[model samples]
Target: MGEKGEVSAVGASRAAESRKIINVVYLITALDITWIFLQLSVTPYLAKKLGFDTLWLGYLQTTVGVIQLLGGPVFGRFADLFGARTALSLACSSTVVFFLLLAVANHPAMLFIHKIPTVFMHVLPASQMVVTDLTEPEKRADALSKLGLCFGVGMIVGSMLGGHLNTRYGETFTACFGAVGNVFSLLLVLKFIPRTTKDPRTNTESENKSKSIFNLGEITRLMKFPGVTPTFLVKIVAGLPSGIFQVMFSVIAMEFFKLQPEQNGYMMAYLGIVQMVIQGGVLGPLTVRYSESSLLIMSIGLTSLVGLAQAYTQSVFWFCVIVIPMMFSLSVFNVITDSMLTKSVPSSDTGTMLGLSASVKNLLRTVGPTAGGYLYMNYGQSSIGLIQFLVNMVVFVYLLLRPLKRTEARKE
Candidate 1:
C-alpha cells in the first residue's frame, strides 16, 4: 500500500508540473500577441511617415531578417545553456526596446537602427523550447499546434485593437501601447516562468562542454543528427514560396488590394479566425489520426493547389476564400515540421534546433522581400502566385518521391 501511494504521489506531482508548464506556455504565447498587434497597428503608418515605399519596406523586412538570422540561433543556444525563462526575458526585453525605438523614430536611419534588437526577439522559439521540454513525443505536434490558438486570439484582438487604437490615437500612441504590452510580457516571464534545473533528459556533459552562444560549429553539428538535415532542408525549400508572399503581404495589401491599415487589420483577423479553427480545433485530432509524413505530404500538395488558385484571384473575396486552405496547409506543415525536428534531437538541444529552424526561416525572409519586390514590380502580383505554384508543385513532387522519415518512431 505504501509503495502504491508513493507511485501515485509521484505521478500526481508530475501531472501538476506538466500543467504548470503548459499554463506558462499559454501565457508566453498570449504575451507574444503584442508583436502582431504592433505590426498591424503602427508599422505601416510609421513606414509611410518615414518615407518608405514598397521596396523600402522590403528593405526593412530584410534588415529584420538579417538580425534574426544571427539572433535566432544565439537565443536558442542561450535557452539551452540557461533556461527558457532567461531566454524569454531577454527576448521580451528586446521587444520592449524595439517598440520604444519605433515610438520615437523620426528618420529612416533610426528606424533601421531600431532593428538591432531583433537579434534577440525570439519569444516564439523560446516558448516552443518549453513545450518540447515537457510534452510527450507523440503529442508534441498537437501541443505545438495549440500555440496557434494564442496567435489566432492575438490576431483577432491585436488587429482589431491596433487598428482602432491607430485610428483613434496615432501611430506613436499605438507604439507606446505596444511598448507597455512588452514590458508587461517581460514581467510575466520573470514572475511566472521558473528557472532551469537539471532536467533528466538534459545531456549534462554536452551542456557543460559547450556554454558559448555563438558556437557555429556546435550549431552546425545539430544538423548531423539522424533525421534533422533532411527535415531542415524540407522546411526551408517547402517554406520559401509562402515565405516570400508573407514577407511582401503588407505591401501587396496596401498596393494591390488598396487596403488601409484598418482594412488590413480586418483581413488579418479573418485569417486568424481560420487559423484558430484549423490549428486550435482541427489539428489536434488530425495529428492523432494521421502520421506526420502523411500530413506533411498532404499539406504540401494542398499548398501547391492554393498557390495556383491565388495566381488567378481577381478580388479580395476570392483571396479570402483561397486563404482558408492556404492557412490550413501552412499551419499543419509548420507544426509537424517543428515537431519532427524536436523529435530528431536530444532534449537538451531542442531549443537550439528550434532556434536554428527560426534562423532558416529568417534566411528566407531576408531574401523573400527583395525577390518578392522585384517580381511584383516587374512581372505583377500574378507572378508571385505563379512562382509559388511552380515552386510548391516541384517540392511536393520531390517530397512525394522521397517522403520524410518518421522521426517520432525512432528511439532517442
Candidate 2:
C-alpha cells in the first residue's frame, strides 16, 4: 500500500479499537450492575439459610477469597493469552453458574463446591488488561476509573434495589435472576466484543517465554520491577480493612447503632455513590494534577483517620459522616494503585504484572476476613478499626519515606 493508503488503514484500525473499548466499558458496567443487583440481595440472608455462625461465615468467605486469589493470576494470564473478551466471558459465565448452584444448594458445602468455577472468572484484572491493551500509560488510569465507576454504579443500583427484590421475590428467585443477568452479559461478550489483532502466542521472545497463563515463576519475577513491589504491597494493605470490615459492617451497624435493614441499605447506597463520585469524577482529574504516589499516600493517611474515627464513634450520625471520607479514600487509593501498576512494568507484561497484583490482593483478602472475624468476635468491633488504622498509617509512612519515581503519574 502507498503512504496514503497505509495512513488510512491505521486510522481505520484505531477507530475500530476505540469502538471496542467503548463497547466493552458499557457492557462491563451493565453486567456488573446486574450482577450486584442480585448478589447483594443474597448476602444478608445467606448465613441465615445456611445456619452459619459469624465465625463460620468468615471461614466460608475466606475460602471463597482464597479460591479467587488462586484464580486471579490465572485469569490475568488468560486475558494475556486468550484475550480480555474471552476471559471476561468465562468469568461472567462462571458467576452465572455459581449463583444458580447457590440457589439450589441444600448445605453450605454445596456453596463451596459451586465456587470452584468461581475462582477462574476474576474479571477485574482482565477488564483492566483490556484498557491497558488499548490505551497508553497515562490514559490507563482514567480508563480504569471508568471500570471502578461501573462497579460503584453497580453497587448503588444494586444496594438501592436489592432489599426490595429479596423481600418481594425471595432468595432463590433473586439468585436465579442474577444468574439470568450474567447469561445476558455472556451473550454481550460473544456478540459485540471484538477480538484482538495480535495472537497471544506470537509475542516477543520475553513474552513468548512467559506464555503460559499459570506461570507463577514468571509472575514472581515480574515483581522485581521498580515500582511493582511497593505498589503491590500498598494495595494489599489497602485491601486488608475491607476484608476485616466489609463482611461485618452490617453487623456492626445493627449492633452498635441499632440500624435496621432499610437504613443499612441506604447507607450502602450512600457508600456506592461516594465511590462513584470519587473514582469517576475526582480520581481521573487528580491523576493529571498530582503524582500517583502522592495521591496514594494521601488516600492511606485519610483512611487511617477514618478508621480511627470509626473506632471512637457511637452515634449513627457520626458514623455516617465517617463513611463519606472513608469511601473517598478507598476509591482514590484503588484507582491510583491501578495507575501505578501500569507504570511499574513494561507494556508487554502488563497483564502478567496485574495478575500478580490481583493474586496477592486476594491472599490478603483471604486472610483479612478470617482474621477480622476473629478480632471482631473476640476483641470488639473497634478492634477492626484499630487494626485498619495502624496498617494504613504504617503503609502511608513507608511509602512516603521511600517513594519510587517510576510510579509517578505522567505529566507530558
Candidate 3:
C-alpha cells in the first residue's frame, strides 16, 4: 500500500509540472502579443500626436512610478495569498482597458492620468509574478529570457504590423486591432492557466492548503529583501534614460530628422527587429555559457557607446544603425537583472520583490522623459544624447565600485 501510494504521488507531481510549463508558455505568448501594440507602437505615436511636453511625459511616468511604489507590495502579497494566475489575469485585463482609452485620448493630462495606475500596479507586478510562478531557481534566468524573447518577437512583428496598419488603415483601426488582440490574449489566459495552489511557500503536507485571499504585508516584507536592494539602484538609473528615450523617440524623429509618423514607425519596427534577433535568437543561448555579471557589464559598456554614437549622428540611417546595439544592450541588461533577482530571492518573496523592483524602475524612468524633454527643448538634440551618455557612464562606474567577489558571484 505504501509503495503504491508513493508511485501515485510521483505521477501526480509529474503531471502538475507539465501543466505549469504549459501555462507559462501560454501566458508568455499572450502577453507578448498584447504588449507589442501597447508599448512599442501606440505609446510613442500617442505622445507625438497629443503634443505632450517632456515635463508632462515625466509627470505621467512619475505618477505611475509612485503608484507602483505604493501598490507593488500590496499586489505582490496578493499574489502570494491568492495565486499568480488570478493576479496576472486582473492586471492584464486592466491594461487592455487603459490602452483602449489611449486610442481616443486627445489631451496629454488625460492620457497621463490613465497611464499611472496601469504602469504602477498592473503591468510590472503581474509580469514579475507570472515569471516567478513558472520558473525554478536555477532556470529562472533561462525562463525569463525565453519569456522576454516572446515579447521581443512580438514587438518586432507588432511594430511592423502596427505601422503598416496605421499607415494603410489609420490609428483608430490599428488601436481596434490592438484591443482585439488583447481580448484574445485574455481569453487564452482563461482557457490555459489552471487554478492551482503551487506557491513554494506552502508546505509538503499542505501543498493543497487553500489560502483565504491576497494580503499587503507580504509585499512589504518582500521590498526589504537584501537581494533586491542593489538592483533597485541600477534599475533607477537605467530607467531614467530609457524612459526619456521612450517618450521622445517620436519627437526626435520629427524635429531632428523631419520624419513622418509612418517613417518613425518604420524606424521603431527596424529597432524591434534587431531587438528580436538579439534577445530571442542570440542572447539566451549565450547566457548559458557566459555569466550574468559579464553580460551585465558588457551590456552597460555597449549601451554607453551607443548613446555616444547617438549624440554624434545627424543622419537617419546612422541613427537607426546606432539603435541596433542600443536595443540589444537594453534587452540583455533586463534579462540579467531579472535572473539575478530571481536566483537571490526566496521563493515566497519573488512576487513582492519583482513588484518592488518594477516600481522603483518605473519611478526612475519617469524622471527621464520629462528631463529629456526639458533638456531637448533648451539645449537641443545633441545635448540630450550627450547627457544620456554621461548617465550611462555613471552607471558603469557605480557597478565597478562593488567588490570583485560579489560581482563575480553575480556572473555565476
Which one wins on TM-score?
1
**How many clashes (backbone N, Cα, C below 3 Å) per candidate?**
0, 0, 1
What TM-score should be assigned to candidate 3? 0.82
Where is model 3 more than 4 Å wrong at Cα?
Answer: 1-69, 104-109, 116-128, 200-217, 404-412
Off by over 4 Å in 1: 201-203, 409-412
RMSD of each: 1.4, 3.0, 4.4
TM-score of each: 0.97, 0.90, 0.82
List model 3 lDDT by residue over 1-412, tens digit each: 9999999999789668755655555455635454654354565566667876555655665666566656666666566555655776676676677657766677777676666546323544555556655555555566676666666656566767777777787666676677677677667666666554355334342334334334444445444656556775676675566557765676687677887656766776676677767776788787888877777877877777777887789999888778878888888888888767665656655665666666666565556556777788888777766766888888887767761123221211
- Candidate number of the best lDDT: 1
Backbone clash tally (model 1): 0
Considering summed lDDT, which 10 consecutive residues are worst modelled in model 1? 197-206
On the 0 to 100 scale, the lDDT of residue 147 in model 1 is: 89
How much lDDT does candidate 1 score? 0.84
Please, what are the lDDT tens digits per residue for candidate 2 over residues 282-332? 878887898776888898899898889988877878877888898888778
Name the lDDT value of residue 109 in candidate 2.
Answer: 81
The models' CA-based lDDT, in order, is 0.84, 0.72, 0.64
| Per-residue accuracy of model 1 over 30-148 as CA lDDT, tens digit each | 76774656555677678887789888888988998999998888888888888877888988998889888888888888888888988998999998888878777888898999888
Ranking 1 against 3 by lDDT, winner: 1
